[model samples]
Target: MRVQVVIIGSGPSGLLLGQLLGKAGIDTVILDRSSRAHILSRVRAGVLEEGTVHLADAAGVGARLKAEGLPHDGFSLAFDGRDHRIDLLDLTQGKRVMVYGQTELTRDLIEAREAESRLMIYEATNVMPQGFDSGTPHVTYEKDGVTHRIDCDFIAGCDGFHGASRKAVPDDAIRTFEKVYPFGWLGILAEVPPVDHELIYANHPRGFALCSMRSLTRSRYYIQCALDEQIEAWSDDRFWDELRRRLPAHHAEAMVTGPSFEKSIAPLRSFVAEPMRFGRLFLVGDAAHIVPPTGAKGLNLAASDVHYLASGLIEHYEDRSNAGIDGYSHKALARVWKAVRFSWWMTSMLHRFPGTGAFDQKIQEAELDYLTHSRAAETVLAENYVGLPY
Candidate 1:
């Protein structure tokens, strides 16, 4: 098979890029190692940056999001036994984020692509991009014991961190910067109303906790845990107890507890791969960078990456200009670094380090205090949370 672009992932980035390009009359194909059912079953964060919402609209999958996604103008930060609200809409000049799950967003993209009859190969095994440095690039994969090849002008590596895309690049060419946090987030999804209308990020003496929601009735909550902690060690009652202890009194009193339908521990890390491009192969989303969930920048950053990649591809096909294509890495990396910094900063401020001294704790408390009182600090949080512009 031959196409203009071969996207080696069916996640949001690849699917959204394909949808955008396909709408622009660009022929693209997506290949994924997972089945459609498996992809849809994966639970992930939903906080959508303003720029991401616009991109979803551009991809023709924003109707359901607009109808069902909750819009938040502000969120609260809990410290010193109180909740302090940051008015994001006011601080960011009316910019706000949408709470929409990644799973639902991927499902929407899948439906839109299928409706338009775009080709997508799921359960593609041993997918690899070859000859990306040459004028004629192609991808190879095996499916049902049969090997297949796709010839394309460009290859998009959206297959994520553990996928073949980034790994295909020679180690010498990749410069990586990473910091793994000492703690992980023990999270649970329950069928109950959220503690508040907007999310609450808590910096408690014991640990960090966050109260987020997928919908009005389905709440997602997380608390800091040791990196070595096991999900099997956390029962629903124990998890609820620890979460309540970390929250402010008022929020804790109002919180509802239920049997968790999903529970897991996600380790925090900040990672970025320099350049984000290797010849005809472009790295997008998790394939290039990862940020701690503290700032909720992972999926949003992926959307921005897709924005740059799609724009470059569109420019190459339309005006026959290589300018955007040539500059894709520099443009995407510039924005990726900023998001990575913000995520790292937020994680540092909120979570307790394993060996934190009294001095360090005092400094963390002081920073939170300043953030609550200073409009400037709040504005920075609001602007980054809503997104830094694509």
Candidate 2:
């Protein structure tokens, strides 16, 4: 099969990219190793920057989100047994984030793609991009014991970090930077209402905790844990108790506890691969960069990547201009690095290090103190939390 673009991965980045390009009269085939069900089943971060919501609207899948997604104006930073609110809407001149699950967003994009009868190959085995560096690029995979190939004018490596797109590049041709955090987050999802209308990020002597939600009735909570901690060791009761210990007294007292339907431990890390563009192949989302979830930048960053790549591709086809495509990496990476710094800073400020000295602890306290007392510092937090401009 031949098409204008071959997108490897049906995640939000690939699906959104395909959706935008298809609307522009560019044909794209999306390939993924996981079934549609598996992709939807995976739980991910729910925070959506304003720009991401706009991108969803542009992709024509924002109807449900518009009706159902919760819009938050501010969030609490809990420390020293108190709540310090960061007014995102006030600080950002009326910008706020949408609290909609990534799963739902992906489902919306998939349904839209299916409604348009766009080609998507799921549960394909051994999917790999071939000859992406050359003028003619194609992708290969095996489906139902039959090997197939897709020839395309451009290959989008949205297949994520573990996928074959980035691996297809010669090691010498690519440079990678990574820092795996010493701790991970133990999280749970329950059919209980959140403690507050807005999200709360808490810093405690025990560890770091985040109180987030998928909806008014569905709460998602996470607490910092050792990287080697086992998920099996945490029961619903224990998880709730530990989470309570990390938050302010008022929030802890008002919190609702219930039987959790989902539980897992995820290690935190910051990773980036240089350039983002490898000749005819363009890396998007997790394939090119990853940030610690403390700043809620993962999915939003992916959406921004789609914005750049889609604009570039559309410009190439419509205006016959290579400028956008040529500058894709440089432009995407500029925003990517800023987000990386913000996520790292958030993680450092909130999380407790294993063996830090007294000076380090004091500095963290001072930083949080300054952040809450200073409007300028709070604005910086609010601005990044809501998102930087595309």
- Can you write out model 1's per-residue Cα lDDT over 144-207, one digit (the tens) per residue? 9999999999999999989999999999988998898889999999999999999999988789
**Predicted structure 1: clash tally:** 0
Return the clash pairs for model 1, or none: none
Clash pairs (backbone) in predicted model 2:
none
lDDT of each: 0.94, 0.94
lDDT of 2 by residue, 191-265 (tens): 999999999999888999999999999999999999999999998999999999999999999999999999999
**Cα distance off (Å), candidate 2, residue 208:** 0.1
lDDT for model 2 comes to 0.94
To one decimal, what is the Cα RMSD in angstroms of model 2 from the true structure? 0.8
